[model samples]
Target: MSDYEISNVDPNQELAEQGSDNFWLIAAIGLGLTTIGIGIKDFFTSRKLKQEREKNKLYQEVLKKHQAQINELKNEKERREYRDRLWAENSN
Candidate 1:
């Protein structure tokens, strides 16, 4: 029998049997890897958002304390100025 001779008469059907199983196996592995990658990305994104929220809270607290100090200084300066004006007017 020659190497190219198949006992079956349908040439189109024999060609369809070549390497189709290998193609499907490779496609399934690729889909599994893509699913794992998306899961890992979501895990890291959630962690980063949590850290950013903590940092923002710390920054707000520091800003509030600085504003309080500024207001106290302004009030002290105004009191000093009023006292100086009163002393000068009473002496004249």
Candidate 2:
């Protein structure tokens, strides 16, 4: 007979004596805590995203105003050049 031979002892006896340790209860508590942490992280992430979106909108509005001013300046310069050419042609 080898020392590693299988015995006829009940496998559940040791667990029963140790009160089974409520493994399912501990697992449920850990799962619930993990879910709450994920929810909190999601909430903060969405809030930051919203803030960034609003900032982008404001920047776009400012850029549009600047572009309009630049277009006005370009038009004025073209008008002056056209007027100068017409005056020179009439004098000649």
Give per-model CA RMSD: 4.6, 7.0
Check candidate 2 and list the clashing pairs: none
Model 2, 1-92: lDDT tens per residue?
A: 65455476678888986665667777889999999999999999999999999999999999999999999999999999999999999999
lDDT of 1 by residue, 1-92 (tens): 76567554687765676667767888999999999999999999999999999999999999999999999999999999999999999999
Q: What is the C-alpha lDDT of each candidate?
A: 0.91, 0.91
Deviating ranges (above 4 Å) for candidate 2: 1-21
Q: In model 1, which runs have C-alpha deviations exceeding 4 angstroms?
A: 1-6, 9-18
On TM-score, the candidate that comes out on top is 2
